[model samples]
Target: MNEAEAAVLIALLHARPRKMSWSAIASEVALRGSATALWDECFPPTLEGVNDLDGHLARAWESLEAWRSEDFRLLTVLDRKYPSRLREIHQVPPILFVRGQLRDDEVAVSVVGSRRASDRGRAVAARIAEGLVDRGIAVLSGLAEGIDAAAHTATLKAGGRPIGVIGTGINRSYPASNRALQAEVAKCGAVVSQFWPGAPPQKHSFPMRNATMSGLGRASVVVEAGEHSGARIQARLAVEHGRPVILTDMVVGATTWARDLLARPGVYLANSTAELMDLVDQLTRTAAGIDDWSNVLPDLVDH
Candidate 1:
């Protein structure tokens, strides 16, 4: 099938499938080796009892065209332009609607934390983001207020790419205040969403967005977050994705979750900007195959 047809079919599968989760649909498509083939098998046009399948396909096509006209790129799991690291995660979205470019080999680190960030936390986030920029790495975040905003703003000022993996649709901005910042990121790097083009922010979407954020980044840096902060969710998801997580001393002292995660493999504690950057540097080296992770964190090694 052509790219457009495949993309539309994936969207239809996401919308029309009953009882099957998007992940399930994605896995089935992967296993079947083609979305078109999966559609033909499960929802053939001549299949009995399948209602309005054609209408759904027509709407999906219209949505795709609308997104394209607005310069939003639709990337399916089948697309070569899809972020390669993201494909490694179990919670990989079936589709991504992106407002900017996504480089398959881009080296990025997620800098995320509490939305109601303390001044010190914001400063620390900015410092960490600037450091990443200096090292020629892109900064990825959820594009929320406080820590996420600080990181993106710092990355922009440092003339670095700022990738925003947002909870809301690529066409909509959450918290409203960051609308301009979202647009700037789209221009400078990317604003990515797994949701359909017009989908609004929902309670469950942020955690899902966090998962994607962790999947996209080389590692996640939690500058400061409280017990219930979404940053904590991203940190946990990062560890699950087998990506390293760097937590600030403040966060560890403030949240039990942070303290609990410290014992996990690939989770590190950073007491200062220097320490954070050192951990990030080690992660970069490990990703490049220049250094072994066990050499960097011997305690994390299995005896």
Candidate 2:
């Protein structure tokens, strides 16, 4: 897709109420270009009609362009460089607008918990994140209040990389309180969002944002989560994406579901930084020969 077309596709994806299919995107592109051209730009198969168009390609192109102006980038599943861990999710975001340098040899751990976390819970999150950073792990969070804030702040204080993936635009920080934290994360690590510039946070956006948190990391650590928590959703997504999930006993009164998570294969129960880092180390070691580590490692390191 050309620059203008890519911009238009991004705008349309951002503007549409219902999700647009690839054939629909191709039709839109066909307004300015030939069907054959649109198909070739977005789809590979020979197109007999609109049904043969690839909508995913258009979404991917627009997403890549969203962060192209930044020093880092936005990568789509179509791009060979997109992170493999994230691609394992069924409903993965069509594109991820990333910033900062994605390097090799670092580690990533998603630290998530209740937004209304208790003081003790917040402290645990902070200390764990700090320790993880000390060991060269990138702290990934939703940029929410409570535990999310604690994790990001702790990573920053430890002189480590902390990536904040938001439910809104990178240009717009939600909650209006973490503006300073957002700036710090942007300066030191990366402030990322799938939403376009100026997009406002909606009630549904947070759930969507959790997927990115899980996708960006090799392992996810849940510091605290109540029944019906978004953190649970993130944990499930992490498992579905084939990433290790480390559940902490930080939350009071575990849900039957949460209890079963520990019994599930590949899920570990972590009570300290040692357990968390061990999980991360194992994942990194297992993925040693993989090329996607080139992007995953740097994101996990101390920037």
Q: List CA RMSD, all candidates.
A: 2.9, 7.8
Worst 10 residues of 1 by lDDT: 294-303
Please, what are the lDDT tens digits per residue for candidate 2 over residues 50-149? 3224354456455565556756565544445656555555555655566665443456888999888989889989988887787788888988898999
Q: What is residue 49's positional error in candidate 1, in angstroms?
A: 14
Model 2's lDDT to the true fold? Answer: 0.69
In terms of lDDT, the poorest run of 10 residues in model 2 is: 294-303
TM-score of each model, paired residue for residue: 0.92, 0.74
- Output the lDDT of residue 54, model 2: 33
User: Model 2 off-target regions past 4 Å?
Assistant: 1-5, 8-74, 79-81, 102-106, 289-303
- Compared with the true structure, all predictions reach lDDT values of 0.84, 0.69
Highest lDDT, which number?
Answer: 1
Q: What is the clash count of model 1?
A: 0
